[model samples]
Target chain A: MEQRLGLEASIAIAEVVCRCDVDIVAAYPITPQTHVVEHLSELVADGELDAAFVPVESEHSAMSVCCGTAAVGARTFTSTAAQGLALMHEILFIASALRLPIVMAVANRSLSGPISIWNDHSDVMTERDVGWVQIFAENAQEAADLTIWSFRLAEDRRVSLPVMVNFDGFILTHTIEPMLMPDKEMVQAFLPPWEPLLKLDVDEPISMGPVGIPDIYTETKQVQQHLLTQAYGPIVETLNEFAQHFKRTYKPIETYRSDDAEVLLCTMGALSETAMEVVDRRRKQGQKVGLVRIRLWRPFPFEDLYRAVGNVPVLGVMDRAISFGGPVGPVASEIKAAFYHREQRPKIVEFIAGLGGRDVPLSDFGRMFDSLYTTGETGKIPAPTIIGLRE
Target chain B: MATQSAKPKWTELAVGTAITVPGSARQNRTGDWRSSRPIWNHEECIRCGVCVIFCPEGCIHFDQDQPGYPSADLEYCKGCGICAHECPTACITTQEEEE
Candidate 1:
């Protein structure tokens, strides 16, 4: 059951979710995300996978159907991109607040109005506060691995939060890569069938989607917040277990060449691999530059990121999407906010780049370092600059 | 045995909380919290049935030619505020429970 030949990450994800024995998958056809559902549909047609594959009309309906199926104690999954995710924006909050352990694959893409069918962080950046556990993938291997990892994290009794594994749309989805596909039995053992503590049951005859009075509404939200924050410890433990079994190490935040470096470049997703290359090349030139790769975006990973970047003289925060009115990029803004109230902090510089699938050449890392160094010395905010934009 | 002492401790706990529990009150109406007080503006009514059709919870009802909307089941409204937001002419309002 191993295919070394070329296969898209989206299709690989489809195969893994099918083999994982997902009870239901409700997805709408959208660019980048369509291949995932299309492959799953073929699995259903050929009788390879025994699951309810609902081809919903819109992403909103897709997510709504997933919520319904997952709430009934079914292990459910779905995929969407860009405006499709924008349409599911309202129910996204409900899925998380209700604490359904539904997992989603978000083929990250730019938001529309200019309507670009390319890669960007705009789609996920807008839903940052939707209360889902967000994890970014650097490659097809991480993308597939995170999908399995997401299930374990989401279904942990303490968390019970939906997870969105965000991978750049065209960068990872369409790119052909040789991925190490784990054995089906191993994945099955790693992620057992989801048995919810509370779900719709015919024999039990319990009411779900109940009305929340204000007296109890605040307490429910408090419980959700507490679970999301407290679940981080268990999530780290589960990740360690996955690492031991599969020999794949995943951290909420990781540092490359930061041990003895003076300046650090912060990035996420597929771009971090490119930045790591730059860090290596710069290191050879006797420059004290390191790279901080943020794997988890939501639940903010504040403490992990803070400790990872610790006392570095200069820190460069790079983002793939614009925050519009915000002073810095959305990710950059959050990172800065983490250090703002602290007594000790790194000299932070924010840069927005790689919008609309623009090529982020490795040479841009040098410019980012220069900006960071200047900002640290001058005690002035660096102008939000784009590294790889066409004039 | 430990089991014998645990039984008396359970009774003591029940007795301690009994003093705070209302002795005379037979039952409390928790349903009052969900009951909606729908207010209709007679002047702004177009009688379009927009609120009725848009109510996903199906808590609003009105005659086709009525001057104002009527409540089909106020007890089940859950106060989602969809009817209030969906009123085309802004004629209807759903109220919150007063503490």
Candidate 2:
């Protein structure tokens, strides 16, 4: 049965993970992500969920314990944001390399110089090449749903790799919303018991992380990369399977009223929902604008992204984080490269907004569409622009 | 700049390929890199097991028939001379490998 409840997104994500019957959860506390593990610990303490919630001293140890549990064929989980995720950077590569299907909730936060614990893509973007199957959730319900889906997809025989479920820090993690949380039996039907590809056992002990020594280092990485690339099919299949079970459908690149759109706005994470509202308001005013939200970030969903833009004459890609002194922004640069080989492509306008938990007002989104429409009419390309910057 | 002609065939490891040996490092002989070998002076030995405790490689085993005299297994030992340095009796000596 689907239960509708108003709860913080972090708690909702924990409840779903509980229903999934994760074997172990190990984490360290950091802002915007603390509530996730706290709730999981509460559930475990109350005996409502039977699992070992190991509280480690640092995020680095948290991730290491998670990898240890996963290597021993336990369904393991961990959560972190910003600096905490950065601390786990070294182990992040090993988790994927060892093919440990450990699920991590990265409540995305910005890097600090100003020491702000705020929402941005800077954290997960830093781990873009860590080889985990990564997906971004735009809202609380999506966050909850994806947490369950991650384990199913990550542990799939064809894709025995770690998965990162990234949702915007504070924006979604702290916000309370009416969420349809699935029950245990329903989730059980969707995900089966854990079947690990490799495990540490006395009877059948196997070696992991030996000296690669140049002769096989490249081959090892080649195999890891190839497995991830081939995982694209299994990803789609699992999403389809989830939809059939829960009646909640998801797409890699979701389109909003783009059928007749001349200009398109693209984004990821929680901001995409805000972008949708702006697109709706502009559409009501007959602006012919639409929105595209990227959910699957890893294997990049290139084909779906290309199909979603669909020759829209002007495309405005909104990035919540900066690539800093690089071309446009991360998302915009990737979009441009995606369309580089195509003859008929849209004139792309890049917008960097909503860094460090700052709100990007609906009016700012309006101004961005105006700039994109102007670029379409004048055939003059604008420099990669920053909106909502204080003068 | 130098380039190798052959590359790893990426197609071979499609989905479930693992780059690991599993269970044992017996296939690898790590002792070949040792510059010096530890030699035992049986006459000066005090059976305090100080050499056994100080050997970083833990390759030394007590020769029970010789009444608690510890000896080194050279196959896995990368001679660091920690046993000789820590031996209270000055019984163990490090000699340069002849080859």
Candidate 3:
């Protein structure tokens, strides 16, 4: 029987990875993400997880080792955040382009300029175009559940793309919460062993990363893009599969009371949980309000987003990441493109908030809704408001 | 105009006849590692021992004579070709096999 246990998101993530029985874990310790890898290292040390743990020198080498191990038909994993992830950006693109199903945990943190150890979406925003399936977790429970789903979605022969599960640093990463831990046998039934299509073998003598001539270079990229674009159906299928075993169902975009609502609040990552209470409080006050939680950001679930907020007069997008000199936040920008051709579209307002670990209180979200409802009537996209900034 | 000519620099183009590699160089295999099959032009000889000293893996050795020239031990060489690049007379050629 399964039991509910209060666990830090970092440790919970490690538990599911251990249950998946990964063949290789190449990792380097870094802030916020450190506890996850540390627990994994302990698991390897104690013989609970029988895998090759390569204690690498840097995040670059860590991902490089992951690329090498995954190329040879081994299930590989790693974790990092902030500068550690920025260091691995070059290798991150290669991991997906080569179609290696390497699963990684990103303890979301602020990118350094003023040098913050706090949580933010800057690191993930910089890597938004890197061809990996990115998911944001709303709590410790989601973090644990998403890790199991990540492997299933990634290793599906149809997908074969890397997956990144982002949990907010300090807020969810260090916070303990009660989560249902599924049994190993259940997870075994959920995620099967990875069987690679093309791997380096002595008998076959196949090549990886070969220098193709100009004649075939475009075709290679076209095939990679086609395979990833076709992955949407399988991604949804696997998520529904996981939800069938577990109680909670996660989608690309989750709707909370979105039906017949006038205004919809959009958010990603752990902050969505905080936004939910704000939606709940105002709903009791007779405000036709709802929330749209974006769990997957890279594929940018266009159809689901359009359907969730259908015919709402005002749609407010809450961004933890900034695109500087752009109107829409990362999520909002993608949503706007989905409605470009539609004759009737909701007035989409963008709110850049909670950067560098600012606390987004209930009052801040209240102010955002009021501002959008008033200014949104004129139909011109209002200047985005930054909530909880250090002005 | 001469600097921007269509002709490539001599250093950029390989001059010697091509050699062939038999197996993968990227993996740490268990068996005897493949080596570069080196050819020596006896006429272009000064007997400088640069190739033997420059080998990082130390798979190169001297001939059995008073004037000892360099030869590679194929059983141990991983085909990195440090010996071919360091040859003073430019007599040795190396080739990496296509996949």
Each model's DockQ?
A: 0.04, 0.19, 0.04
Would you list the clashing residue pairs of candidate 3?
none
Q: Candidate 2's residue-wise lDDT over A1-391, tens digit each?
A: 8899998889999999999999899999899998999999999999988999998999999999998899889999999999999999999998998899999999999989789899988898888999999999988999999999999999998899999999999988999999898889988889999898878775775555545556556777877777888899999999999899889999889999888898899989888887889989998898899988899999899889889998888999999778877885898899999999999899989999988988888898899999989999998879888898877
The lDDT for every candidate, in the order shown, is: 0.80, 0.87, 0.81
What TM-score number comes out for model 3?
A: 0.80
- Which 10 consecutive residues of model 3 chain A have the lowest summed lDDT? A211-220
Q: Grade the docking of candidate 3.
A: incorrect
lDDT of 1 by residue, A132-214 (tens): 88899998888888899898888887778899999889889999888888778889888887768667666654444544444
True contacts kept of each: 0.00, 0.22, 0.00
Best by DockQ: 2
| Best of the two (1, 2) by TM-score | 2
Best prediction by TM-score:
2
**DockQ score for candidate 2:** 0.19
Off by over 4 Å in 1: A1-5, A389-391, B1-99
At residue B56, give the lDDT of candidate 3: 76
Worst 10 residues of 2 chain A by lDDT: A207-216
Q: Comparing chain B with the reference, what is the TM-score for each candidate? A: 0.53, 0.73, 0.52
